[model samples]
Target: MKLATQAIRHVDLFAGIGGLRRAFDAVGSHCTFSSEWDGFSQQTYEANFRDNRKVDGRDLRDVQAGEIDDHDILLAGFPCQPFSIAGVSKKNSLGRDHGFADLTQGTLFFDVVRILKRWRPAGFLLENVKNLKSHDGGRTFEVIRRTLEEDLGYELHYRVINALHYLPQNRERIVIVGFKEPTSFSWDRLVLPPIGQTKMSSILHPEDGSEDPEGEYTLGPRAEVNSKYTLSDKLWNYLQGYAEKHRAAGNGFGYGLVGPDDTCRTLSARYYKDGSEILVKQDGRRNPRRLTPRECARLMGYDDTFRIPVSDTQAYKQFGNSVAVPVFEEVARIMLPEIERIKKSKPQTLQAVA
Candidate 1:
C-alpha cells in the first residue's frame, strides 16, 4: 500500500536514537534533516532511519543558521542537562554561571532559534524536563518561551504530560509547541486516546521457555538478586522517608517494586548509576534489580524494529536523552485531522502537501 505524501517535513535536533523521528515516522511526517552530537546515537539513528544517515556529530553552533532549507516542522529535544536535577546539583556551589547564556541548554536553544530564524518552518516541537519551568529561577524557561513567541512571532502552546498516559511508564515531560499562526492550531482542544490498561506481565517476556525476537532486548537477566544491594538500610530509609513525606501531603513518592504485570516509572539517564528509583519485584525473589536499558526502551514506547545498535552505555544515554515517541505520534494524529480540515477548506496547492 502506498502512503500519502507528508503534508509537512521535519528536522530533528539532538536526535537521540531518533525517538522524535520514530514518532513522526509513525505519523507520516517526513524528515528533511536530522542532527545529533553523540556518536552512538548517530549510529543508531542511521541504522534505523537510512535517510538521516548523513547526520554528523557536528556542534550545532557551527551550522550556519540560514543553511537549513525550508521544512514543514522542526522537532528539537534539546539538551536537558542544563535544566535537569543533575544540572542544578552541578551548578549549586560549583561557583559557575548557569543563566540562559552560560548553561549548556542556553547555547543549544540559541542554535535552535537561529535555525528557526533561517528555516522558518511552519511549526516546531520542543521537549524538555518539567523542571524547566523552574530552572535557574525560571529565567531559563522564560527565555525559551519568549524567543519562540514574542521574538519569533509564533503561536505557542505547551503542556506538561506524563508518559504513563500513553505507555506503561511513569514519566513526566513538558512539550512546547509553536505554530506560525496561533489560531492555526488549538492546543487545548487536542484530546488524546485512552491510556490503555496494562500490567507488568505484558512488559515481561516468558521465562526460560520462551524466545524473544532476534533484535529484541536481551533476555539474559530480567533482574538481579543480591542481599547487600536489596537490604540496604540507606535505601530502605530513603524510601520510607519519601513515602512519609508524600503521605503527609496526600501524594505518593514511595518506591514501586512492581512485577511485570504493572506500569513502570519514568526511566532516567541516571538509571545506569542505580535502579533504586524504580525497581521491579519478582515473586519469590530475595532481591530486586533495576530495569535494564532494553526495558527502558520498551517503557519509552520504542518498538523492537527501532534498532538499539549502540552499546548498553550508549543505549542508556540515548534513551535518557529521548522524547517519548508515542507522545509525538499522538500529537501528530491530532494535528493531522485539523491540518486536513484546513486543506479541504481551501483550493489545494502542491505547497499544501509539501
Candidate 2:
C-alpha cells in the first residue's frame, strides 16, 4: 500500500543515537523534535544529524510538554532499564528498587505519556525490552496498558519482535503502538523475514581486502580485525573457568561463543566490559574476539554509512541501547497507512460563524 504522500512529522523521545529516527526516515517521515539526555549520546546524535534544529539535550522530565513542537506522531524507545531482565536482576542484587520504584530512569515512561496527552498525536510507537511484559509479574505492563488505553483513550496494540528476522543478533523487544482513534491496525500487517535466515556472516566484516579498514576497527590493506578485539589470555581463561563453574552448577550463565554461520546472543550495554555475550570464534588456537564497533553496528541493523563519532565504550553502549533499524522500518511502513487514515478521519476544525 502507498504511504501517506504528505510528510508525517514525529518527535523522538529518549532518542538513542537516532535509531528510530533512521527507521522512520526510511519511510519518508520528518523529525520535528528530539530529546536525549546522555551527553555522549547527544554528541553522537548531533554529529550525525547536524541539520536537526530542535534536538533537546536536557532531561525530558525538566522539559514541559508545551515546549515540544506539534507533530503527527510520537516515537519513543524510552529507557528500558527498569523493565529489562538484566537490569532488574542487577538492581535486586544491589538491594535497589526497580520498575516504577526506581524513580530515575524507571519513571521516564510518564514523560512519554505526558507528551502524548498534550499533543494528542494521531499515533505513537513505544519500544522497550521484551521483559517488560513480565516485569513485576506483569503488573508493570498492566499499568502501561491501562494508562494508554483507558486513561488517555487510545487503541493500543503491542507485540514482541525479534531482530533475528532482520539481523544476526537474537534480540527481542516489545513494540507498543497506539492510535488516537481505532483503525484496522493489526500485527498481521508486519512482514518478518524467516528467523535465522540472516546469519552472522551477513554482518561480520569480510577482512579479505574487499572492504576498506575502518578506523581502529580493522587495519592494513586487507582490513584485518584489529588485535585489540581479541580477548586477552587472562580474560579468556577467566571466562572459561567462570563458565565451567556455572555449568557444573547446572546454571545457564556463560559466554556465548559463535561462528560466522551462527547467530549471536543479545548485545547488551555491558558488552564493552568483556564482550561475553557474543564472542566471535577465531582460527587455530586463537581466542575468540569481541565484535568490532563496526560489526556491532551491522549486528544492530545499521548500515556502515551511519556515523560512529564516539569512543568505543560509548559506541558500544549506544548501539546496545538502540533498536534494530529494520524491525522498526517495517513497523513504520505498516503504521503509515493507518496513521494517514486516522489523520484523515479527524473532523475538520469548524470555522467561527461570521
Candidate 3:
C-alpha cells in the first residue's frame, strides 16, 4: 500500500466525516490539513481523527490559497448540488439557477480552482455526482476541463465509476484525477469486485442474536435493530399509495423496498426525514425499516470501528453525503504511483535550473 518511501501528505477540502481521508490514509498518505465548515461534521471529524493537524473551521472561500499547507495531493468532494440530478431538479422546482449560474453554491468550484492555481499540488482527486459531466449542457464540465488543463497546466483523467461494483448500492460518482506531470496512470488498474457479491445482509443488523449490542444504536443484549427504525403504519401506507399514483402517471418515482438479497438505491441526505429510498423488507405482516446509522456507515464502506459521535439525523446526512470508501480506496491505489512519480520528478526539474 505504500506508494512512496516517505509519507505522502494530503489536504482534504470539504472533508465530510473523512471519507476520502480514510481511503488516502489506507494507502499510507498523511493528511496535513482538513477543512469542513459544518460544525457537526467538524465534530465527527475531530472525534475520529484526534491528530495534531488542526481541522480548518473557516469557509474555504474565505481562506486564502497560501493558508493551506503544502501537500502532495488535494482531495475534495466539494458541493455537488450545482450539478447533481436531484439537486438540479429541486432547484428548478424552486425557480433557482443551478450549475455555476446559481449565485450561492454553484461558484464553490472556483475555490478548488484557486487553490490548485496557487498551490499546484503534485496531484489531486476530485469527486462529484456523475451528472457533472452533463450539467449545463456540458458547458460546466468544459470550463472545468479547460481551467485545469489549459490554464493550470495539469494532465487530467476522469471516469464515472459506479459504487455498485464494490458496494450494495447503486451510487455513481464521477472521479477526476489530475497530475502536475503525466506518468503511467490508467483507469484499467481499478478492479471492481463482482456486483451482487455483497448483499444487504452484510450491512443490515442481524436482529437474530448473531451480533453484540452497540451503544444506543441497538436495544437489549442481541443488538437487534432499534424498533424506531421500522416505518410507521401510516408512513408505509402513504408511500405505497404514493407509488401507485406515480405508476398510474407513468413515473418511476417510488419507495425502494429491498430484501437481503437485493442491492439498494442511492442513499441520499433526505433519508433522515423519510427512509423512502432504501427501506429494508421485513417478515410477514410487519413494516419495513430504515437503516440504522451504524448500518448506513457500513453501506458507505465504513467499518464499525469508525465512531458516530453525532445525532442520528446528522449521521444520516454525513454518511449519505460521503463518497463510497472502497471506491475511493481503489482510486487511491491507482493514483498513488502517479502522485509519487510527480513528487519525485519535482526535485530533478528544479536541480537542472540550479
RMSD of each: 5.0, 2.7, 2.3
lDDT of 3 at 194: 86
Of candidates 3 and 1, the better by TM-score: 3
**Candidate 1: RMSD to truth:** 5.0
Q: What's the best-to-worst order under lDDT?
A: 2, 3, 1
lDDT per residue (tens digit) for residues 1-354 in model 2: 235577677888999899998888888888889899899998888877876384798999999988887788899998898889899999999999999999998999998898888888888999999999999999999999999999999999999999989998899999999998889999998899999889999988888999998999999999999999999999999999999999999999999999989998999998999999999998875799999988999998888888899999999999999899999999999999888777677744312121
TM-score quality measure for candidate 2: 0.96
Model 1 residue 63 distance off true place after TM-score fit, in angstroms: 0.8
lDDT of each: 0.69, 0.89, 0.89
Off by over 4 Å in 3: 348-354
Which window of ten consecutive residues has the lowest lDDT sum in model 2?
345-354
| Model 3 residue 268 distance off true place after TM-score fit, in angstroms | 0.4
lDDT of candidate 1 over 1-354, digit per residue (tens)? 112243666788888888887887677777877888878778888888877248857878877655554566788998777677766678766965554655455578888888887656667889888988888788878888888999988878888877776777777889888776534566566565556465555555444536453333443443232233343556656766877899999996666677766777667776665565677765675556555566667777886566777766677767866888778777776565544443345434424211
Model 2 stretches with alpha carbons more than 4 Å out: 52-54, 347-354
lDDT of 2 at 132: 95
Question: What is the Cα-based lDDT of residue 254 in candidate 2?
Answer: 93
Q: Name the lDDT of candidate 2.
A: 0.89
Clash pairs, candidate 2, are: none
